[model samples]
Structure formats: structure tokens, C-alpha cells
Target: MVMKNTESSPDLIDLIFKYIEEEFPEVQDRISELKPTIRKEFSGIETYIRQRSMTDRENQIREVMSLFNGRNATEVARRLNISRATVYRCIKTSAR
Candidate 1:
């Protein structure tokens, strides 16, 4: 036996909207207004991640430098898997 679809597109949409309005009344205004802020929210998260990455890099460099007794920059860079230039830069920045 074949079944015919009784609901039209508008009818289905109306039913969905009514269900949403009843079940989620708080977000009804956001749904109707539709002012998306996804990019703004994600940009804030990206900025936070960037700042955290910088802080972590600085801390790692400081720890490596502190562990340096009489090791050369090349050895320190090899041990840390960073460039010798980065080790030198960290040393230069930390001295200031």
C-alpha cells in the first residue's frame, strides 16, 4: 500500500515553527531575528588560543634556558627541537 503526504511545505514549516516556539520559547526570538554572530564568537576563541600559544612558547623557552648549565645554543636547540636562532632570541629576550 502507498501512502500520500498530507502535509504541504508551508504546513510542515508551520508545524516545525510551532513545535520550536512551544518547546524552545527562549530561542524563538533568535530564530526569527537571525542575527548570526558565529564569526565574532570564533574570532574571540582564535584570539584566546593565539595568546595561550604565545604564553606556552615563552614558558617552554624559559624552562629550556633555565636548564642550560654550560650547554651551547646549538645543543639547546637540538634538545628542544627548536632552531638555534630561537634559543638565542629567547636568551636575548630573557636577559632584558
Candidate 2:
């Protein structure tokens, strides 16, 4: 499968289907048919990945904030390569 950063867990399944479509064209139709069952069977895995991703993201944000001593969201965003809005959103969400 082509590898890249994914925004959420479901993007992973999309990548897998894309890989299958490219590598095994004959199974493309079958893949669609099995999508629901596959998703159901892997629900736990998806949940785990989602949780881990969120935890990692939160930890990263916290680290960046801590390093900056919570001085500036723009600076943190620059260091973290994320939007200032995202940095603020994370901070706000965590605060609650």
C-alpha cells in the first residue's frame, strides 16, 4: 500500500482498498462487497487505532505547549507544523 500520513482511522481502510484496487484489479468488486463485513470484524482494531492516534496527538500538543511554556499558540503551531486554530482547539478541548 502507498504509505502516507492519515487524518483518521478510516483513512487506513481506504488506503487498503486503494492498494487492493491497484494491485489486484480482479478483486476490486469483491472488496466493495466485503467492506461492511470487514469493517465490522475490524471495529475493535479501528477503535484502538483511533484512540492511540488521539492520545498521541494530545501528547504531542502537550509537549509542544510545555516546551513553549504555554506562551504562544502560533509558536507552538510553527514548531508542531499544525494550524494555530488546531493548537487552540486542542488546548481548549483539553482544558474541558
Candidate 3:
């Protein structure tokens, strides 16, 4: 059995498989050879994206700060079209 991204929630994996099934129907039979190679590429990409997400958070903070004349959580939430709690959690978690 090949390992998949541990952090990929089940729904995401399902969606990915759905996409693959649609885009590359040939993978269904030769999954063993395909999964490992794809998994490695995906893992590298996931790492890069995680690193980039941190940079994006800083940019998000800057944009939010500019929009609200400072980092006003509520305004940031409104601008982002997300809940206030989500905005708070994103800012707090991204701090780490």
C-alpha cells in the first residue's frame, strides 16, 4: 500500500482521486507504480506550499492592516468574507 499525504484530509483525497479519475482514467489499473511517484512529487509540493502559506499570512496581515488602517480583525473578516472567529484563528495560528 502506498502512503498518501498524512495531512490531506479524507475529503481532499477523495476530491483528488475524483480529479484523477476524470483526467487520467489510465491510472486506475497501474496505481502501484503511479502512486509512489505522484506521492513524492505531492509531498514536495505540500512542503513548499506550507512554507509559502506562512509568507502569504504575512502578506495577508499587511493587506488587512492597510484595509483597516491597522489590523482590525472585524474589518479583515469582512474583507476576506470569512467569519470573525475564522479571521482571529487564522491570525493566531499563522503567528506560529
Candidate 4:
């Protein structure tokens, strides 16, 4: 998934607006009135949580990659149940 920085984030506030607009159009005015204050409070917390999650996922993938020694990309991919392309990308990324 593509990560969004704070300036570009569309977190729970956006979701609530969308849900209100789609499912309860009659309440649209009320939702819009609440969007800013709610977004200001939640977006920072949401972005921090997302960044940490990405770091954790990348570390886990790195750990999985470290378990293989001199294995071909295809073999490593199969062992890890990931695509060969992903394995190759990981190897290239880790090298840098």
C-alpha cells in the first residue's frame, strides 16, 4: 500500500465524511462541520501508527530474507511464500 504523509493523509475523518455522504446524505452538513476538528486530532496519531507498522513489516521481511544463504531468488521466494519479484526487490533493496 502506498503510504501517505501528514499533508496528504485521508484518515478516519475523511472516512467518516465519506460514510456520511454515501450512507446518510441528509447528515452531510453535520459531518462537514465536524470534519476539521476531528481530522486535526486524529491524523497525526494515524500517521505515526502507520509509519511504525511499515517499519515493523519491513524488519520482518528482512529477518525472513536473512534466513537464506546464497539461495537463488526464485528459491528464496518460494521458501518465503512470496513472489520471485518481491524476493529480488528485497535483495536489491537490502543491499543498499
What are the per-residue Cα lDDT tens digits for candidate 1 across 1-96? 986676643443356566888998998887554323533344434332253577787897787678666568888888889888888888877878
User: What lDDT score goes with residue 59 in model 4?
Assistant: 79
Query: How should the candidates be ordered by TM-score, best one leading?
Result: 4, 1, 2, 3
- Point to the candidate with the largest lDDT: 2
For each candidate in turn, the TM-score is 0.44, 0.44, 0.39, 0.45
lDDT of 4 at 7: 79
Over 4 Å off in model 1, which ranges? 1-52
Better of 1 and 4 by TM-score: 4
Which one is best on TM-score? 4
What C-alpha lDDT does candidate 2 achieve relative to the native structure?
A: 0.75
Tens digits of lDDT, candidate 2, 1-96: 887655554565677788889999999779978877887888767344353577788787677657555768788888889788888877777678
lDDT of 1: 0.68
Clash count for each candidate, listed in order shown: 0, 0, 0, 0
lDDT of 4 by residue, 4-96 (tens): 796777756676689879998888778757887787766657343353576876875686578657577777777778787777777777778
> lDDT, candidate 1, residue 23?
97
For candidate 1, the per-residue lDDT at 18 reads 69
Instruction: Assess each prediction's global lDDT (C-alpha) against the native.
Output: 0.68, 0.75, 0.65, 0.72
On a 0 to 100 scale, what is the lDDT of residue 20 in model 4? 77
Once superposed on the true structure, which residue ranges of model 4 sit more than 4 Å away at CA? 1-12, 16-35, 38-52
Worst 10 residues of 3 by lDDT: 43-52
